[model samples]
Target: MAMAVPAQTIAGYDRFPWDAILLQTNSALMNNTDPNVWASQIISTLRSTAVTLPSVDLAHRLVSHLFWNHHSPIAWKLLDIAASLNLLPPLLLVALLSTRIVPMRKVYPQAYRLYLELVKQYVLMLQFRNNSPNYEMIMESIDNVLQLSQVYSHKVCEPGVALVEFVFSILWQLLEAILDDEGLLDHVPENKPRWLSRSHDMDIAEHDCINEMKTEQKEGMQRKNTMIAIEIIVQLLQNKMTSRLLCLVHRNMPSYWGSFNHQMQLIASKSSILKNLKHITADTLLSLMENIHGVVSCNTKSKLESNVVIPAGSQIAFGGQCEGSSWSSIWLPIDLILEDALDGGHVAALSAIEIITGMNV
Candidate 1:
């Protein structure tokens, strides 16, 4: 029945006492106050304060407490607010990635968008070429990405997933070469086609390596991280491009909505991207498909770890049953190709036939 005290009102007399604010917030949480009330209060306080915001370390600690204590929406929102003000700490963004505070559900688009905002800022700040300041954070992100891939293999739309298979593929080859050199494959991932294994054993054989070798290894990792970052940007660019095309088409030809997909398919078939792929080997194509399959297919052998932690005195009970869909029997591409063939698109049909026959080889 009591109204929540505004954080700005609380701080109006005082010069932004973060410790007191934290204590009050904890008390409010313990007393079972609505998360939104406290979140609004915090955001208002941060935005309207005349004094300096909390230091990077202090802000990270505050956000971590906020995240661990109650609902994640508040935590995610606070991070976004901090990021907009350019007050977000690198570690806080890293924590966001590790915790995945924003659930990867289509319904929670705003929360996920805020999550990406923080991630993009952190990524832009990273200079992957040199000895980066946020090396630990970078490595932590990579580890979390691998962990997430194993847990949510069927959820390809999860952030950083596009790079998962490619990164692992390279790591697998690197490990393989090292093992071959050392004459032992003693501790490897459980499955064959090692890149798709339930987990990877990344411990390299110790060697009396020169300083240059160590430097080279570090540079290699930096390059790998750079590639992953670039891929994330590329995916964003592709999405933007599709939206732009859709807008242009919708604006110019309102009646084209009926056959939009058909037109798009035709355009793609004749696109220079496909036509210029004259040197793509069957093995390369098969590997690319296999990588995609590995990403989107659920591996029964892998266990999904629970990241949910219930704080003390929190009576909140979490439970849910997900109705998993059955895997489709047909590949949609094959059906589309068949339709193209039947529709008398001779050139496109011939291209499809060549690709399929090459796959059979």
Candidate 2:
């Protein structure tokens, strides 16, 4: 408000005072004597005081000083600036993954784009993750992704969902493995599976993939290690567990606009992923079908995981209530694949996954 008060005045606020500068420069605004003007006055004083400093941490100070106390659209504008400056915490990570953002969404003409902004944030996280920086950056990025996933679960677009699943799945897998090795499984997430420790547990009998080794040789060792990673994922997705979770979430979703939480739930299942054979189907699936209103168009399980990339042609379109009437269900070579019900939720979720994974396959 005070001519975007410069940083130099910040350090010297109490001396020459930016408030005086504002009183002189913005005499009209100062005349009102509104209490809201206090922030402006203080900032002006800060500018005059800080006029000598070479640079300033305006963004960091903004949140601590102003936005924390009085959040508003204007305050968010400062945050947007900080986000551009790599200052603000990633807020809409799930949004970016959905291909629902500005530039990326603009590229995909026909695919459903809902939460691209969140997914963009996710892409940043992945890039940072793959860059293999310090533990803090990786952890921060994963935290942001998980946070976005939870925050935007109901808002996810089906087409963008697989991408989200892929990114979060990989991160979760890595985190689980790390925690397990460190004896911190209970400290992290409890559902992780297929470790050397729990072979006889019947509660997860179906998720025996991680513990089984084809051989102990070098090649077998590599294969077995990757399998272990996938197994951890499967446990998270146990017993039609992912699909069941998706069904529960789809109920509250606003019909077609929602994300693929259901499909993510399905993807979380390891048996459904590795074996590609339906070992078990829930009886309550009928109720799940009723709720989704879309048929279990296909029940084929997937066999891909973190290292095993989703094949180039694996992605398929999902048509929900919009099926038959408006949206035509077509099979395209999408980078993402949905193993859930042929509904809106899964389709959107795949798009998000694509964005985060940055995988064309």
Candidate 3:
């Protein structure tokens, strides 16, 4: 199970001001103190078994000094050293960097890209354990990442396509991690017959009980994962991010859409949030279709080749009803586009006019 190291409070110094230490560190750097010296000392103290680490808030303030003073080479060196020693908390780093990304982006494009890469690496290192007991921390970390993506997407543009793509990739990983836990429950061994287990029946019985408890825990986790998945999907829709994300996928990852949609559908079905699933899904598809129409119309008016690439398998067909839920009428235009794409080699403009006309009708 992946778990964050809890912050440790120092005895007799519970109210120690971290700002003073940061100021001292900065003063030391100005006096030409080797960054390795001060950086190593701080990191060592944090890792020491005998000493206590500061509270979470103070810890963040101390570590964030490096990010806030990123103009100094000393700060970057310290961050590199901390990351090397696995002492840097991924969530804290993400929060700090993401909040300041707008200015960093404008002032230092190269540093912005490098720090964003580091952030991506840190996020990938985070994984939710099966039946982890640290629910609050894990959920907070997830929420932080979601908010980080929103900030990055909204504030950073121009050289921001890579950042956008990274957001989608991490979101997919988070969803997949949840799905993997659900997959584990399906393979749990059935109980052995009591008659056939006489010799080791006591141990067997205890094992069975443990397994039963684990199964129940996993079921509860599944419910929570479902709600999280719904939140992710809804945010993507509300921000209109999925359409651009699909274009990125189409250009570089043609095969992912199939499984991505399946994951979305499975997650939706598992939660009460699915009550408006059809409406939400329709709105998402309609937005994408409308964007496609506009792109095609522009290209046609200019008699230029279109730059749009439709996501492979974006044209999925649905019945009048799926399970008990009725398909929304808004899906009709999207369905026509899907049918034409399946037959016409996934061409972006092939049925765009017809679909738009159908929508108007």
**lDDT (Cα atoms) of all candidates against the true structure:** 0.33, 0.32, 0.38
lDDT of 2 by residue, 153-265 (tens): 42423323333343444334333443333344443222533222221211222222223423343334333333343433333233232333333224323332132223223
Each model's backbone clash number: 0, 71, 0
| Candidate 2 lowest-lDDT run of ten | 103-112
Give the poorly placed runs of model 3, Cα more than 4 Å off. Answer: 1-14, 31-36, 47-59, 62-64, 67-70, 120-361
TM-score of each model, paired residue for residue: 0.27, 0.22, 0.34
Order by TM-score, highest first:
3, 1, 2
* Residue 131 displacement (Å), model 2: 8.9
Off by over 4 Å in 1: 1-18, 23-54, 90-92, 95-117, 124-361
C-alpha lDDT (0 to 100) for residue 198 of candidate 2: 23
